[model samples]
Target: MKQSLLEVKGLRVAFGDKEVVHGIDFQIDQGEKLALVGESGSGKTVTALSLLRLAQNADVTGVANFAGEEGGAARDLLALPESKLRGIRGKEIAMIFQEPMTALNALYPVGDQIAEVLELHQALSARAAHEAAVQLLADTGIPEPARRARAFPHQLSGGQRQRAMIAMALACRPRLLLADEPTTALDVTVRAQILDLLTDLQRRYGMAVLLITHDLNLVRRFADRVAVMENGHLIEHGAVATVFDAPRHPYTRKLIDSRPQRDVAPVTARQAEPVLAAKSLRVIYPVPRPGFAGWFRKGEFVAVRGADFRIAPGETLGVVGESGSGKSTLALAALGLLKHQGELDVAGRRWNAGGASDRALRRVMQVVFQDPFSSLSPRMTVEQIVGEGLTVHAPELDAAARRTRSLDVLGQVGLTEAQFPALLDRYPHEFSGGQRQRLAVARALIVDPKLLVLDEPTSALDVTIQKQVLGLLQRLQRERGLSYLLITHDVEVIRAMAHQVIVMKDGAILESGPVGQVLDAPGHPYTQKLVAAALAD
Candidate 1:
């Protein structure tokens, strides 16, 4: 029989006078992949962090018995001395955070970061540690591992950086791994690759794993056993297949069924003129060349390669691609934020490079950014933030009129004074993520824009919250006949919200057609690969 690698009993976490995580129990068998799944604020992440005594300002109490790496005597992690726990961390047990950019040191090369782990845990010399770091990166499937080892965190792409993080985490061949939302920030194909790599590494190293995430599709893909949490409570747990097939808890069932579904209207005839149109549109950037050429001239990099598309009134055109694929560049060009070649028109009028005449079209095109918190001003109140657009598009409106329009628009996006007393007075940080996004949408709507550029609008939201926001957008579109240029990497979202879809890769459109046709029967191999990845998830 397989022995339990780690077992927890009566785990409780508190911050000052307020307790967040109630008592909970769970166990991971040796070489097992156990997933702790829940939405934001479910205490899943806190529970895992507290197990390692890494949660700052947190008081953790529990019995976390961890078997030694070589199957020797077990120790209570919760009761271990800080010095002893440090020895265990990154050696007997390690962690991979959700965002590699923040977790990885920006100043040092990723190789040094991995080498640092090896030096601390394995007691290896600097030279030996550095050599081993390159090997580790290679094992994680990074290309040109030796060269990549010298590159800093920001220099590497998202997937490459994440792979480096995994290599560092696994450097000492830990007995157990705690991965907190490891693939949440990754693209679909990259997410699948990471999961597969982790599975292979776990089998090779014979290490048990605790996967913490809000994504159920990932849990289904990666876990053997599943434990669901809700608002700091452990709601249910069982084998992955058993729980998914017959979820006993309401929250568990809801999560399982929360994958975005096609809820918008079908693609209709494009009889009307397109609100936004672009033909053979291209965007380029200049980069300094190394050595001799750099002194005199710079080389050019094409961001968007002759892209052509359109979005009629009440229609949605989704542009899906991986990071650095230039979907964002196309959106920027469409928004008149970039210089582009070829013909591009908004409402049958061209952008005169930010001329006063372009201001007229700006009112017809407003955008909702990906991260609402960062995009929104922290110092600005809801009234100011939402009404700021009005000053540009509707300058005739006074403060009182602007405030009234802001409140009405907010109410339209599902925010109201009844729900949030003095809603206009609150700042961005004062609201939840979903509420903040609602404010962003309300801000755009207050200008009475005919089109919206949604740049991964729900990518930062929780699953249920994503559904709510998408529903709200769909409702508003149906009522207001709004056109949307939706930019995202989520195929499920594209399937749900978009009428027309374009698959982009390396700054070029690989496929373009109705969502049903492209998603259901993709003609391009890359599109097929994307569709397959989404299906696997």
Candidate 2:
């Protein structure tokens, strides 16, 4: 039998007095891919970080044995001397962090960063290491690697930055890779590409990977074995097929069953005039053409072209597509944020009417942005944030009235002074991600908008929290008879929330039909691919 590459036993992690991870045991065979699956704060991350002795401000104990080094004695990473561990870190075991934009150095070129790893571990000169860096990027299926190598972290796309991160982690040809939610921030197509890249590279290097992620679909596609964690305790571990097919632990079952569920009320008032309507809507942008210094003569890029859609008074019209598929542009056009060359109206009034009328009409349609923490002002209190809309939309209401209205809407979104002490005076940063999203909904709903545009509302959240938020939105829609212009790439989310759905690709609407019909039997090839790429694990 092959020797285990890593054997972790009695692993425990704590932050001060609170122990996040309890004693747990697991092992990975040579070239095996094992996934540590759980939601946020599950201690999977700290477990991996503890192996490398990288967990900060926390006490980590127990044994993490590594046998990656050839002809050398196996080392207990938790007990290894700092100096010796540093030598073995990038050489034998390397890590690919979750967020590449923050994980990578913004000041230096991606190639230089990758080369730095080679210089430290492989003892390669700067020039040779840099050349190797470009090759590694190309191996990861990045186009024009030499050019992309020179670009900074922010300059590259999400997928490219992740690939570059992978290249740097593999620069020293480590025997084990610790990847933490590597594709969480990426689109489905890009996430698939990165998984394929990792699979290929892992086979080539004969490396074992400890993948720490909450995405079960990714685990199904990539991992050979799985370990489930809950509230920092390892509850179950087994072959991927066995565990996923028939989860023994209730927590594992809960995680698997947490896929978005459809509970939305069917549209019975389809004949009613739509809260929002658009026909032949087109949004075009001017860009500088390549070569000949065409800055003087720009090229035209059509972001959304000839789109037609309508959301009934109490129905949802979902726009589904991948990144750069013009879904968001269509959303912007619907919101009256972008100029369009077509017939579009909100509550029977055309956009860009100018002055008080336009501002007042805009209140009929409100938007809940993707990221709530960023969308909400940090300095403002919860009452201030939610009631700010009332100031503009209902100026006649005094401060007391605004506060009353704010509390009412907040209650609709599931926030209450009962749960959160001094809730009104609290700031945005104090709330959890799911709670923050709820606050965003309350802010949009306060003005009593007829149409709510939910833009990837739950994508940033994990499955459990995502389920909660989707439930909240579903309840809100049913109770208030709210019309929604939901823009998202998540097929499950569309199935759960939308009544009517439109599939878009490259600024063109490829298919339009009911959510059940489009999802269950996709006519378009692109739509089929998107649905197929959903959460199968």
Q: Each model's number of backbone clashes?
A: 0, 0
Per-residue lDDT of 1-537 in model 2, one digit per residue for the tens? Answer: 867999999999988899989999999988999999987667888899899988888899899889946757788999989998999788889998876776899999999999999988888988999999999999876778988898898667555787888888888878999998777655676677778878887899888899998778788889999999988889999999999999999889888889888898888888877788888999998765678978579988798989988888889999888766788778878888888899998988899878987898779999997768668999999999999999999999999999999999998888999999899999997777678999999999999899999887886676888898999988888888999999887787898889999999889999999988999999999888888877442
Which ranges in model 1 have alpha carbons more than 4 Å from their true place? 71-75, 80-84, 100-168, 266-269, 355-360, 377-384, 391-402, 425-432
Q: Per-residue lDDT of 1-537 in model 1, one digit per residue for the tens?
A: 999999999999998988889999999999999999887677888898998999998998889999875658999999999999999999988998766876888999999999999998789999999999999998876767988899899777656777888889989988899998777556788788778888998899788999987777888888999999998899999999999999999998888777776667654548778898999999998865778979999999898999989888889999998766788789888989888999999989998646787999999999998768768999999999999988988889999999899989999999999999998998997677778999999988988899999998987677887888999999898888888899988999998899999999889999999998999999999999998888888
> What is every candidate's alpha-carbon RMSD to the true fold?
3.3, 3.7
> In candidate 2, residue 412 scores what lDDT?
86
Q: How accurate locally, in lDDT, is each candidate?
A: 0.88, 0.86
Model 1 weakest 10-residue run by lDDT: 260-269
Error of 1 at 450 (Å): 2.3
If scored against the real structure, what TM-score would every candidate get?
0.87, 0.84
Off by over 4 Å in 2: 50-56, 73-173, 354-358, 373-384, 391-404, 425-431, 535-537
Q: What is the lDDT for 325 in model 2?
A: 78
